[model samples]
Target: MPILLLGNKDIDLISGKRNITIRRLWKQPLYRGDRLFCYWNILSKEREKIFEAEVTKVKILPFKEIISNSELPHKLGYKNSKELEKDLKKSYPNNTKDNDEFQIFEFKKLHVTQWEGSAINQKNMIIKKADILFDMGEYEQSSLCYQAALEYDPDDANLLNRIGDNLSRLGQFGDAIKNYKKAIKLQPDNEYLYNNIALVYLNKGEPDNALKMSNEAFKINPKNTTILYWRGIIYEMLNDFEEALKYFDEVLELDDTDPDVWNERGTLLNMLGKSEEALISYDKSLELCLDDTKDSNTWASKGNTLLGLQRYDEAIECYDNALKIDDSNPIILNNKGVAYMELDDFQSAIECFTKVLVMYPNNPDAQVLQEVCLENL
Candidate 1:
């Protein structure tokens, strides 16, 4: 899917023995199960097609995790991973920041081709290109590639569905729905397409239709936790909290370790003014959230319930946890400032509100809170 360039030395070495390529900050797309055209040039931008390779495996890693590992880089002709990282830093200048991720692709070289012109080869390349772009998070470009592929063979339901997914991500809901409906006509049993249609309806502010479609998908497979989760979300958005709770309860019953469902359950319980019960749900979410940084809203929700219960110190602690994950969130800052105000710590409150104001200059609540803190001082 990705066309990559290898220097003559590296290309020769890989063709002889090596099979893995360490990747960093690669903007052009590639994925496992993708066929790649690899070009090698001894000098300058002029390239010669040396090999066609099929990606066999892909492993993604953070710099911190792989930096200490010397084994993998050594195989690729590096003295060690540190030397490799240094070289990678020059190649991927944008990845110098903390927590940057890189990938390693293991491929086997297929026969080299100087020119590719067969209709089957062209179609495969187009679909492979689309999948690579999709994996790179370039949805619009991926959609374009998929669209181009469709031009070559227009009746592909999978391509239509993929195009719909990209359009939905771009918030082109109407066009997405049209494509989805086409896919559904071809494959009606695809519950996920119905789920996508439901999501599009939700984004269009037609919650009733969203609910209907979700229910339809759920009826197709009552045990599908994802469909039930969407049904819960739609009910929650419609302010039917109790109805939302039923679906959330069913989802958790189906899978107790699901952190997202637990978090949603906590939010719903909190909305229902059942603060103590909500705390247990939040605690469950925190326990299940192996990657807590990805669950900042759960921490913030826990803080909100704590604040409502007037547990100012505990609320501040929870808010601090949330801030650690997303320090610049104005809503969390505002809420933390309110917790400080509740404890009559006006100066601390002022600082938090000031931060919120800096992030959201026109925020009325933060502005009023700042004024109130100043007056108290």
Candidate 2:
């Protein structure tokens, strides 16, 4: 029987009761609380359907020992403890995957053997309080709870990282950086710490420093794809297109299906005036687009490409698609008016310019375009 703790590290596993004796299992490996994600294909007797449950709990008792109890069945979702651990590790990437999908989650290991029942009880109470604060978005208060937990064990790197993360969320970037630095010093090999620190630098607009930190992390573990992706973005911002292209190429080689990367590559190609190549990139981006974010950007990119090619009518249609996605966008509105003027649709041009003027009353270009459209009318 293997039971994953849903939340909070303070509760006992074998028995739901607080202040129970935890043996050696709890002693050797420090347990950080985990939000349970069980992979199961179980049939519900009443529903007669194979259903899945992503059981979330504010706190969990040790359920791994459920098999030992006569009332529980011997069957388990995972084959063994090692397999379960491996799955847990795979759930969060060590960097290869990009975007928010690969974000690191807070997890702790609790050993059933070494826990002092009395201490566990008190810890459970503390964790419950912290959970409430965290739910309320009181990250500072939640961090304080984790900090207080550290008084008993100063060497807990996981808790330290969580505290830093919370601080970062609260916009205390400098303080978060300090905590992350400390965590990196303590656990020099932790990729998450390095990445977190790099993020702080990026948020602070120190892209050079962020790139440097990300490079160090990449060097430590070349397989961290997230760092590679971010490094490419840094190079892009710095206008080092060749280097940025290299990194983007690497990401594409790994996951070519990411429309955002294709869109970005197209932008770089456009910057270099490789209109034909940029069009191809934009096409790829559109092919992989599954949502408005990807689709909208594709429309905008196509509009720019057409405008560059002097295809005014085509450009107007592209801009219309983009405006459909984000109607109030000033840039798209202005661009649409420019396309209308180029196509000699003076009436439509005036309407487009008037819309822009309504949204941005001080827009000098809109006023000028409006004047031109009215003069031509």
Candidate 3:
């Protein structure tokens, strides 16, 4: 099953104005008689099947020769060779050398009645749809699509892994592990399959089991940073702080730009009562963080470190920054309330607790804390 993804050229393709598509040579080159599944890749990451087409011809030509042919650019719906060259460079920045080969696929659109394809093609189509759905965060729907594809090719380890991923996102840990284990059985040498199983066990609050699976992945690829990072996380969940810190340091030495690792290190340091060192890690995490949600978590963690250092005002400032990004987090709200309480501002503390209680009516700690604030006033 050959799939052709067109970006911003669906209208031209449908209108028959563009019959040829030039692409960098794929691992599997298109044949003249092959049925191509044409898809329009929308800017929002959505993919729509425009139509099925048959490859009428395929021409393999060097980049220099293709650019020298002036008439070919107009046939490709470009105004001139320069426009085509610009588009090609933008699409394939690394493959613009004069000697680089490009495949020009000339296709003819088939009628809806002529769109019937093989069972394998149908499986590929379903997998493509499932991939798009997964990217869109429709995990349940994507899982169902993957299941349908699995019926057609049950032995596909990649399909099993994809199904496991969706199941994990949906919090179906038991089923996720089942799929992951199935994948592992099929591809025992794949370290990522073992890591996936470890993650499922970790989510199920079984860090000991997670560590066993993670250790298998580590054995397969000891230098893999992802495996090292997960090993660090598993050790943290098992309360083996020293071992967790050791792995975290290993990861940082390999890739210092990972904000999540820095944040985890800060958390582990904070738990060990090293407030000053924790602050440094938190600051590093914040500096590297690009996501607002992660930035909020790092800020909240920094606030906790400041609070432990008895810097109530600085802690409150950090809490305020965290709240600005995620005002509804009850844990942060309660911590902010505690900061206020430490400053002897009982009324402000009560307000913070009240906000938490409003969001979570059954929050016993917030309820008790609010009463204590009232008692002080």
Candidate 4:
């Protein structure tokens, strides 16, 4: 029987469910009629045989199509399909037939493995606690726990990488870089680690070094879309707008449904003073967007482009759409006020600016704009 290790969340899988598990079973010697054994909480050494299941069916499909499924996202315990797809793309870009997209392993979970709980090691317990903290957005506390866990196994590259990721998010750029370097020393070809280091360099305002690091990662995984996206970002940071656009265009060619790439392309076009072209790209991003896909930001960007083109009414409508998503966002309110002012609607402009002033008490620009509106009134 092939052992199917589970996480704490996977207990729900065995009781009586049939959610498709996403594990690399290509290397496993298995056929459709094979019995797959299950163990719950295996990572913490909880080698309890939970249940057994017969593999009735198995189909490998491209991740792009898999992520568009509504039920699959919740079954996989993801907030949304887009988020799940992004993660899969980053982790399993080489899993696809094309070697550019993710290949999802689809199977039905049948029965429990029949064993329960063994004591988890102290190190794993600490690591589990750290993972919980990290999930709760307590990066500092998580980093401390991860660091503490490191005492049990000083040479753990995964631990070092996790600590480095936490430090990077905490804005400890120097420490983050040190931890990433340590991980690299232990595991020389971890392309994701190199990419992580590149992000820190970008944060430190060193686009040159960021590009260099991204290039190194590219050498390792030439077809990773995430790395390609980062390269485009680095180029944008370095004011190489044309190069950035080219990379984003390439990403779109590979996967046109990715709103992030479209958004970046729109931003680059906007920077290049191609307002109409920018609007088209922004619209494409919006059209590709799913429910609650942060359309407010895209709407706001489109509004800004229209505002530059002096289409004040259209801009105001776009701003209104943005406000519907986040009614209390002061920045959007301020922009809407400016749009109203451009249309010579002094009353509406004053009302919008007043909202901004109330939300952000020290907004000098809003106050000044409100004063102008009052004069026009």
TM-score of each: 0.67, 0.61, 0.66, 0.66
Cα lDDT of all candidates, in order? 0.82, 0.65, 0.88, 0.78
Residue 189, candidate 4: C-alpha displacement in angstroms: 2.1
Clash statistics: count for each candidate: 0, 25, 0, 12
Residue-level lDDT tens digits of model 1 in 96-129 = 5658888777888664352352223545555665
Residue-level lDDT tens digits of model 2 in 1-377 = 12323223322211122222221122223233422321111112211111112222222223333222342221223455455334434543352221221111222323424332212343444445555657778787677766755655677787678778888889899898888888888899977788788888878888888888887788787666677677778888778988888887888888888888888889888888888898888889888998996688788888988888889898898888888888887778878888888889989988888888888998988899889889988
Worst 10 residues of 2 by lDDT: 46-55
**Model 2: runs farther than 4 Å from truth?**
1-154
**Which numbered prediction scores highest in TM-score against the true structure?**
1
Order of all candidates by TM-score, from best down to worst? Answer: 1, 3, 4, 2
Where's the lowest-lDDT run of ten residues in candidate 1?
A: 111-120
How many angstroms is residue 152 displaced in model 4 relative to the true structure, after the best TM-score fit? 4.3
Off by over 4 Å in 3: 1-121, 151-154, 171-174, 358-362
Instruction: lDDT winner between 3 and 4, please give it.
Output: 3
Query: Candidate 3 on 1-377: residue-level lDDT in tens?
Result: 88988653433564355688789988898899999987756445666675789999999998999899989998888889999999999999999999999998899977656887532365676677678779989887678778867866799999999999999999999999999999988999899999999999998889999999999999999888899999999999999999999999999998999999999999999888888999999999999999999999999999989999999999999999999999999999999999999999999999999999899999998999999999999
Q: Which prediction has more favorable lDDT, 2 or 4?
A: 4
lDDT of 1: 0.82
